[model samples]
Target chain A: MLALGVAFSYTAGWLAPSRLSAQRIVDALQQNAGWHPGYRRNHAKGVCVSGYFESNGAAAAYSVARVFAQGRTPVIGRLAIPGGNPAAPDDSSPVRSLALRFDLPGGEQWRTGMNNMPVFVVATPQAFYEQLLAARPDPATHKPDPARLAAFFAAHPETGPFLAWAKTTRPSASFATQSYYGLDAFYFIDAAGRKHPVRWRVAPETADHTDAPAGPPSKDDLTDDLDRRLAQGPLRWHLLVTLGAPEDPTNDATRVWPAERPTIDAGTLVIEHAQDQASGPCRDVNYDPTVLPHGIAISDDPLLAARASAYADSYRRRTGEEAHVPGSAPAADATKASQP
Target chain B: MNTHPAFHPLARVLHWTMAVLILAMLFIGVGMVSTVSSKHTWLLAIHKPLGIAILVLAIIRLGVRLRFRAPPLPADMPASMQWVAHASHWVLYALMFAMPLIGWAMLSAGGYPVTILHGWPLPPLVPAHGALFGWLRLAHGVLAYVFFLAILGHMGAALYHGLIRRDDVLPSMSFPRREPSPPQMSDAPATTQASAVGTALPEQPPEAQPAGDPASPGQGDAG
Candidate 1:
């Protein structure tokens, strides 16, 4: 009875910080770096390595034995403009790209490539590139040419729903309440410890268009909106299962993951507070498929594999940085090892 | 060792190395901000340490400046222009040091971990606090923009000398040359004690300001 009470209190404390003063956090860290409670609740009701990363992390459960167990891991995430295009409109709803890094608690380190999009657009590498190119500029206009849509449709016929969502004017029109879909299908493990392919989506309650995408709002409206939403309350996601129902395993990304329903409620995705994702801290982050914990993986989604390859290439080319990190990486030369 | 008692070897070397480093840092900083990939993190890893190292070098450079006097300007150069150059150089030095120091301070204040390449973590030099960090961050950002502009002017002057005027001033300061000094026609050294400092032509030089001098009037600092 006493043990149950202690566990319940610890879990409650984990869910909500009764008090958040320097006094509370410092006291918590000193007591045990908050690990005593943090670890005990590592698999907290709805948490699955997502909390470690500000956004999402590699579900390293499949290959690496390093991050096999639970522990407080070092990680990072970035909020950025998506589509790899520098000129993309800033006001496109779902303000910034959140790339989460999870330094696994016990051993392995993984980084999950996540977005608000549950189902990704394409499955194969070739299709992925085709879609990406199609989404880019028109030679004459030198802007995101609308005619490229036909090329995308011709090459990757399965991007129906994705194109539908991407083409929706509301997302572009409404600046405040924007939803960013990872668009790429990834896998996840259910609370029952069963493997189920899933798509992670960041559904910002306040992210639709408070104003037009071209409104007089600052270019940082997306960031400001995200910050506001996070401050208001924990940002949440509706986990929709993409596998185990009618979705076939091993088929390329060209086909769809037949929807699974009743979509088992796996867990909630939440961002705690106003984490300043800036250039100094966020620039070196990666999104890899091999960074999962114990019960999730790439789901044979060619899109996941292709994304990993695309990200790795772009990551290496742009910054000369490696993407596949093994484990905990605290910045070097700091006298303060842990933040505590 | 040239026409004028130019910048010493150490000062010259530090100036050029910092220039290269700062240019690289700014380009990388700008590139890092626009992308969405692991590269962003990679660039930051470089930016943070390079920034810290620049701060250290700036400190050393400051001590050197305070301890030693820079060589006198060319006697033929205008006194007002020389004073402006001197003042601007000092401001540049101050900016060089302050930008990095403020960056580190901002990181410390914002609760972001500050690290050097040393195997150990950097000590939190400032007390960890949120609001303080925000102010420091704002200061660092504003100063970075200011520094960028200063660098632009500094480089513009250099390019003007190197490209347009075809003068040796830019090369002398930017790159090393150990040739013998031009023989002094006058008994006294230029820009010192009794020698005249202003151009022989008076305030508005009928010919022009020196090749390496700031072309604009307002840009001349109040020495």
Candidate 2:
């Protein structure tokens, strides 16, 4: 019985009392990948794009970051599907993601990775690791154990809202119509050194196009649709920031701030052109959200630092694979490169 | 057998106010669970404060009931129907008070603070507990359905009295008009209707009962 307990813990990735390392978490994510080697641990398949972000100067009230200055800043963005397999079909994934790097004046940069999901599934980094473990496929069945998943869910009641949301939220017909939300909170420091916690999301100007095709969606449906739409006009998303109220739970990404809290329209992110990652300017970029300009700093949210560490680990691993096999699968992999 | 003895002006006012608020609350409650859009946030803003309003008014309405006699049920009404009327009114009172409290406790157990008027926060009514939160949420939802059914039943009965029966039952708890009662009023009925109207009028002082004035609108009705 004691040995059985040890085996269960080992398989579940709860390596005793020590806090989970970034590598351990990333490895668990990779284990979820099906038939994909050296792919991004998460959101591997995506289309890179060129864009510019115009700040409305409203965000300046919360943060003294120069990135929020009222000007057009060059941007490299990637729209992605939520999965670890680079070759997975677009519609196979339920959540769509947006990762961006904004070039600022004075050689600084601001980076962010967002998802169409309003809230993340787990609250803490440990809980997230456990979730990955619970989702891992059984070696024999090649599917996650239903009993394990149920046990994990029962333990994490905080996941209730997110699970409820996933069932009801409609899949977007086009990337242009999907609103991308940053699942973690960050602290913005004003000139007075006062800090305010904020979470932000990009709301598309176009209404939600939730009418998914009745049948199997084409493999490149999102990318193809976005490219064709860009030919008509530039797609725009508004940067809306909700300031946290006093009782707002900043540490938990699963809980949403009360809607009545004041929101500031930070500006607009305009996607001008869609490009494949192969030769796109954003090809070599890593949108680690912790890479912030002045006046923006990490909050006490444990998930933020965990994400930063995991992103660093992912970037190094992917780049190492590239170095090992230069130009080997460039054409096939570039269109579905590790993006978010 | 069909007579109109107006409800106390306070009861009428409370009924109408609560009616609009409860309907709005039900829709907002439904909307809160159905979407994660910005509109959902607006619904919550209206939902929390509005629930508190209903809870507060239900208490005040119950307290005011002590000062006056409720109008009698129709002489020809079935005994079972009369019993349902009394039972449903108490159920409405209980549910109106309980829904907000349950919602408050549910949010509290879920570790969410209820916000009012901008950002004014209400203290949690219960400790944060997942199982308790789930149970309270389920209870709140179930009771809402019961509350809705009771409201429908109440409204149907009112319509039957007003439109089909042409009785004064509907007017008893609604805005009183100057029209003479369709059925001849007895002494007790006349004074009760007069007092109900007096309470309904915003300009009339509720405390202005004249000594030795049995017909004064300020005089409390005898059951």
Candidate 3:
């Protein structure tokens, strides 16, 4: 038995730990985007904010979740750029992420990580892993191998729509001016036990109306823009829940429901303050997409489980490192004053 | 003078070393699953190799245990308490071996490379399959809780013997402490032959000889 144990310990690499495992995916991510210790494996650059979602009770028609019960639900959130590099230039990545955790009454919580894009790039975790590999830069050339990307694009035709969307859309001027979409579909359970498939987005009240002062883009442009805007006053976004038809694809995040789907203006999300993530209340939050409240249930989207796993892995890695936020002391007093 | 027989020196060394390693492994495992920060990588980096180390050490410890007899329980201790002690020790040995083996197999089933020291990736113990990975992961988690509870029980029992009972059970595994000699026996051997012989012969009654026996003081201090 001891010999068998020793033999098992010495043997190396009969099969690759599959790319599908969360660890493998995270490993690939760290490799593709040079590792940044003490930061998120993805969406490394972020600013924390505290706010509240003032529900108008309109969403109670679709689901029985307490957040829609005509009252204020406290929220802590992070605004981030999608990449592993914490100091990546603001304009380098087109995607922006909004991760929020709603602290409801009775100690229940709803956490979500949303993107500014209307649809996600891939339908399944496997494709996302392959995409990461294809996007990995060659050590010699310092660029993604064009042949590998071409082959990936050829094999995964579902990526075409996302690519087209990315090509047509420009990065928003400020984090506050973008509409964040919960790309994955979820089932809203009503009091009667009926499940309604729905997709949600928080549309900024000031989108398209605010003009960014034209200037050369700095590395911290987006973060600076947010700070300048928040200093003046609070910013608000309208929570819109789009009800899905029976034919809508709940499992695939890459597919979009028709624009004409009946939408409900559930609430207004008011961001009262912004703080540095290093010492912000949102620093330790995972923002796992599957962390739902009593009324919300995860759909069959494979990406949801994969995301929860990956986020968990990323959280574990960063928390183990020293709490080193690149640039400034935590504004503890300012953040404390903002709490309700 | 102390008259109780003590464990072999190597057995005591293995016990303390494993005690520290197992405690660290439990904390690392808990931290690894609960967070998504960059530290997750660092914790996992430590957790994988630490597990394998424990496995190797456990095997060696088992070998030592089989080669040498442990100090018998105090003669006055109840039969039920002795049975519990023996059963718990076996359970701990089983967990020490099972935890790492299951962790390795789980990683293998998940298709994750069981890399140690950030390099040397161990071969998969099983082929990659999602369902199997899921089950193995569940088992690893559940067993970890059981392992933790068992450890708490073991520590509690050790402390009970040391503090409340004030018996030789705890001292048997503890580092040997020096004892003052009795002035009356100027030329006698420092330790009683019966105490020394008791360790080498498992069938002997636990050293319950009267105090001031010439061999007792030396046997108590022998490493």
Share of real interface contacts recovered by each model? 0.00, 0.00, 0.02
Per-residue lDDT of A311-340 in model 3, one digit per residue for the tens? 766664565443342321223332111110
lDDT of 3: 0.72
TM-scores, in order shown?
A: 0.42, 0.54, 0.61
The per-residue C-alpha lDDT of model 2 at residue A238 equals 96
User: For model 1, what is the error of residue A1's alpha carbon versus the real structure, in angstroms, after optimal superposition?
Assistant: 77
lDDT tens digits by residue: candidate 2, B9-99: 8776776778878866876665444332234345656788889888898778766665665554444445466456556666766788899
Alpha carbon lDDT of each predicted model: 0.45, 0.68, 0.72
lDDT of 1 by residue, A47-151 (tens): 111233222223333223233233334545445554432333455443334455554433334455554444456655455444544544433454445666676
**Is model 2 an incorrect, acceptable, medium or high docking prediction?**
incorrect
Candidate 2's displacement at residue A50, Å, is 1.5
Cα error, residue A210 of model 1, in Å, equals 30
Residue-pair clashes per candidate, as listed? 52, 0, 25
User: Considering TM-score, where higher is better, how would the candidates rank from best to worst?
Assistant: 3, 2, 1
**DockQ score, prediction 2:** 0.00
Error of 3 at A45 (Å): 0.6
Residues B141-193, model 1: lDDT tens digits: 45665766666666565565446543334544654334433532331343353
Per DockQ, the best of the predicted structures is: 3
